[model samples]
Target: MENKELLKRIYLLVKPHRRRLVIAVVGMVMVAGLTAGQAYMVKPLMDRIFFDQEQALLNILPWAIVLIFLVKGLFYYLYRYMLESAGQRVIRELRKSIFQHIHTQPTSFFHKTTTGELISRIISDVTLIHVAISRALIGLLKDLVQIIALLGVVFYLDWQMALIVFILLPVAFTPIVNFAKKFRKYSVSNQQTVALISNNVHETIAGQRVVKAFGMERYEAKRFSDLSDRLYHIIARDIRLNSLQHPLMEFLGGLAIAAIIWYGGHQVLSGQSTPGTFFAFLAALMMVYEPVKNIGGMNITIQQGLAAAIRVFNLLDTKPEIKDQPGAIILPPFRKAIKFRDVSFSYNQANPTLRNINLTVVAGEVLAIVGPSGGGKTTLVNLIPRFFEVSAGKILLDDHDISEVTQTSLRDQIAIVEQQTILFNDTVKNNIAYGDLDRSEDEIVTVAKAAHAYDFIQELPEGFDTEIGEGGARLSGGQRQRISIARALLKNAPILILDEATSSLDTESEQEVQKALANLMKNRTTLVIAHRLSTIQNADRILVIQEGRIVEEGTHANLLADGNVYRELYNMQFKNSNSEPSNLTP
Candidate 1:
């Protein structure tokens, strides 16, 4: 990310909260003015009471001192609160925008990214930006004010002394800048390692069950330790570099101060300068060095923040590959057919997954697709829902090109039950109702019955109210698949897809579920991607796909009579079914 573009983005986030930001800036200015006023008051008090020995001024000095402190303290508290509150509000909005963007990103986007990295960016990088704005900016402005105010006082008291002080400024500042530059490099390194450590911890915790099951707890721990050690060493190096700042500044400032005091004392004795003027100049010189040191430290923090900002901007700048086209329209209801014409697709263009596939499924027809594992059956079905775009050719619904319709409209008419059940870690009723979240309980029960899920659900301790474990691990594979079918049934879409939906079930469960499926498939354009040929032999048409093209298409009876690929698949399954007598786990 270019620095100019990055700053522009960051500035936009602040724009919504501009009123608060302006108030914060006003508060900072007020605080700096009060602090500088208090510093300026010191010299006046010393000159009147000690050097001049003015009796009346001496009598008023104590009260004046107390009043200055009182005013400074009040402004300090008020402005600090205002700046902090404004900064926090900006941070809140920034985090919300980032999270909302991530939520809307498509499934394919997540397939190529890691959850660990995304989470770290939202949690850690945004926080660094927040601190930079809230604390560092305020500190930087105050330091600038302090330097300007103190320099003005010193120059007013004695121009020659001020000039001398200015000449030494570069000498005192050079090493501090050089040292901070090194620490800035180390700071960026440390931050990256810390992010790496966070990613590792998130990954390990998410997969802890697998680690424990394989008895690899020690191995996981050692991996974490190794990553953490790198973070620790990087942090140690950064700290060492930061440590050089304080003493180096102090040494240089000290030598300059010692020289100033010696020269001033000689001038006072020789009658070239008065004790009052010399004392005031000396006091102002003492106050100048602190602000200079703070400014140096603030620069280091800003550099670290810039590094974090680059990562954040990179994420924000990324364009999602799949987005709605201009003037996209909602897909009308499916009254005729879903057609794929000369369709070919690949996640990467170099290696095609689906090639020149031409097919159509008319309204209320069952189309079963059978193929070897890598022959693109699943990929072809995925294109119907626009889970991915066809790299070449087009898919049409009712002869309307799907790409012309909005993604949500295209998906609203279709439903899918995959090989694995995808139930949320929620109550059984909610999982089924998730298909149409606004559906009434009565409606939920109707669909569950239609999927043969009501019987097993009622047998559970809490019936529909029972909390199913993550991925529905609390239930058997057959039961989970039934719940998934219940979800699809509840969707009541015009098109239904079953991708090996019954492959994991027992013979008895399959028989019961098949009855429910028969009912669900009635009057809908249905597609089944099946591994078991027996389940699909009854389909209205079986499409035997091989190497991304349909090699055979016919009814079960005709395909069997033809003695082709479908017949061979049917015979193999028939022989196995007759030979293997089943008395297995239910």
Candidate 2:
């Protein structure tokens, strides 16, 4: 993305508001013409009032000058208001577009990108762009108009003096172009550093409990200081460049004025130019320099905005890897089995996560998958909903290839409850009835009661209407898990994928959740990513996967009798406690 293309895209975005922009440009032109008119009056004031001693002209000239300023102020307000209004609307749409783009991305996108960086891009980077649109716009457009109008005044008074001024003026601004490249470089570093700071803050806050437990407050503080110091260095470089432009413009403007004074004084003495004309040229030239200074000051802001726009545009260009195929059809209800034929998957394609995996989970059967931490258990479950496309093979849901179905229809039939339960900062009822917002209160209560969550719901201050705070922070671990289970129960999907992460709970809480799990798994085809033996003890069939391959498959007792991978896992789990692995809590 070159800057030209970026600017073109931004122009397209601004096109919808062209009516307001045209009016604003009209107002700006009026203000520019009036600016030159102010310098024009200096000529009459010098020649008529003082030199000719015209008493009658004084009254009209003062009132005319006052009228010019009053009208200029009106146009100034009009243009400022219109430009900002247009800018705000464009930003609103741009921010929303960015958010929607991020949501449409595949799950793997989230795996590779952090929440903090995305937050920084949406908030910090967009704000930089906002400043450029709202502030730099006025500087660039209005200043250019002012420069042209003022140049007309100087040229009208004496083209030779105006030519000399224009020649020196370009020299003053040449350094501005030289420094622009550095401005963008520093700004990009600054935005990235801000993202690092955002990431560090998000981590510290999300893991505050761990930070306290490990007593790493000072360590985290040091890390944050490092990020802040990095931002400071980058910002300092940008500001230094900005400051350098200021003095260079002042020096050049001073040289131009000095040359004008010497030449104009000689012209007036030689009767080639009048004092009034020379003075008016001096005034117009000075006003021209003011807009030049404003432009120079905002140059860094504009360049920084362009840098931020590059990042924003790049993010927008990343189309989602997972989306509906052109001829995809809505999936029918799940009635038979989900079969994986020669299904091999890898996150990066370099190393296989699931290799030549062939399996069938029949409808209404409880299939327990037990494996080492990184043995692809979760990845296997994720493939069913098409969170990631299979690297090589296809998944068939009820004899229909899942890839051939619309993702929304395919996902509608599946309900998932994982180790880290996800709940929004909404009400208890809303969380449970997330997909079915139109569900009645009675229906919500029915699912809540089934998951053993209705009792806790009544205990809260607002009952079913209680705000759970972020990620159910206000609730106990068991309470949150039960609410999560209630949500899945409400979905009433035929297929259920449960992580069975009850190992983190107390004995009593685990029992409560286990009861909820029983209700949730009653008639659904369930896949349990089992970590403990208690979860899979009653499973119809247990699978043992190791290093992306199925090592064994049988009931719990049959696997133990085989005395292979399953038996070794049983020994390792129980060896930590007494002989009773089932009684040993997670």
Candidate 3:
């Protein structure tokens, strides 16, 4: 994005709080005026009170100086408060907008990005922009106004001295601008390293069980240490560049002060200028450098903020690959069947995962899909919910192309229960009600009872209100799967997809969850991906897929009679189960 365009976008974020910004700017103006007034008072104090022995002016002048500072302090606090308040509001809105945009992105986008990286951008990068708005931009404007006001005082006292100071001022900006560029380059590097460290920490903590089991603690520690060390070096370089600005500004400021003291003092002693006038000029000149130095520092901050903004805007600019077409109609509830007409899909164009597939699933029929790992079973089902777009061909629901309907309406008619149960760190009630948030307490209990989850749930101390730990770590695998079933059961959609829902459980748990799955799948058009062939023996039909192609399709008895791939799979599973001692009833 262009600089102007970036600035305009930032301005829009602040535009909502423009009234508060205006009030803050008014306070800044008052502060600048008071700062100039303090310098202006120096002349009367020196010449009238000290030199001329004006005793009456003495009592009033001291009080006036105190009063001026008291008012300036008040306005200073007000403006800082106002700007910071506005800055916080802007940060809140920006973070929300970025988060909402992230949700709009396709699943493919997440495959290419890490959760840690996105979290870092939302937290760290947005903070940089916050500082830029609340500190850098406000400081730049306030300092500029103060410098201008102080310069007026200097020129009024003596234009010749003011002209000399102005001439050398532009030279000081050269090093400041160059240093700012270097600071920004280092800042970007620092943020990237921080993001890597975040990713490492997130992965380490999330997979800590694996780390402990594999005894890779030392290796993970060393990896994190290396990333932390890299970050330290980048930050040190940024600090070196940042520290250089202050002393460099002081050197240039010292030179300007030295010139003013020499030439202005000479004029005073030679009777060409009054002592009071020369002192006032010196005071104003000294005050002017403070704001100038601040402005120089703000330039570096602005650069850092701009770099961060570029990253944030780049993410926001990404258009989601899957969105409803313009004028798309809302799909009504499923009635007849789902048809995939010559469907093909590929994550990358070089390789296809599903190829020229034509399949129809009639309403209320349980269609079992049996396949080897990586045979596109999951990919085929995911396309129904528009999790990914098909590379070629189209899917239709009762003759209406699914792409011609709103995704929300299409997904509303379907519910999914996957192998890995996903439950948030919330109450059991909330997790179950997620399927249909409008469900009442009684309705939630009904579904829980239907999924066989109510027995253990009531055994908990808090019953429905118990807080489940992250991903339901507090619950056993069987309990979690039952809760997942309860969630799906509550949706009561016309279509259901069960992807190896009982694969990870033991015999006892599988038997328990299989009952819950039966309750959830009742009267729904169900698609089952069976990990164990025994679970789907009663399915209306079973399709065997291998290497992205349907190799066989028939009833379990028919497939067994044919002695094809399905029969071989059935025999292998049957032999394996028979060889092992089993507690589960046949």
Choose the strongest candidate by lDDT.
3
- 488 in model 3: Cα distance from truth in Å? 0.8
All candidates' lDDT scores?
A: 0.79, 0.86, 0.88
Model 3 lowest lDDT segment of ten:
577-586
Winning candidate number (TM-score): 3
**Which residue pairs come into collision in candidate 3?**
none
TM-score of 3: 0.96
**Model 3, stretches more than 4 Å misplaced?**
579-586
Model 3 agreement with the true structure over 52-133: per-residue lDDT tens digits = 9899999899899999999999999989899999999999999999999999998899998898889988999999999988
Candidate with more favorable, higher lDDT: 1 or 3: 3
RMSD of each: 3.5, 2.7, 2.1
Query: What shift in Å separates residue 177 of candidate 2 from its native position after superposition?
Result: 1.0
Pairs that clash in candidate 1: none
Worst 10 residues of 1 by lDDT: 577-586
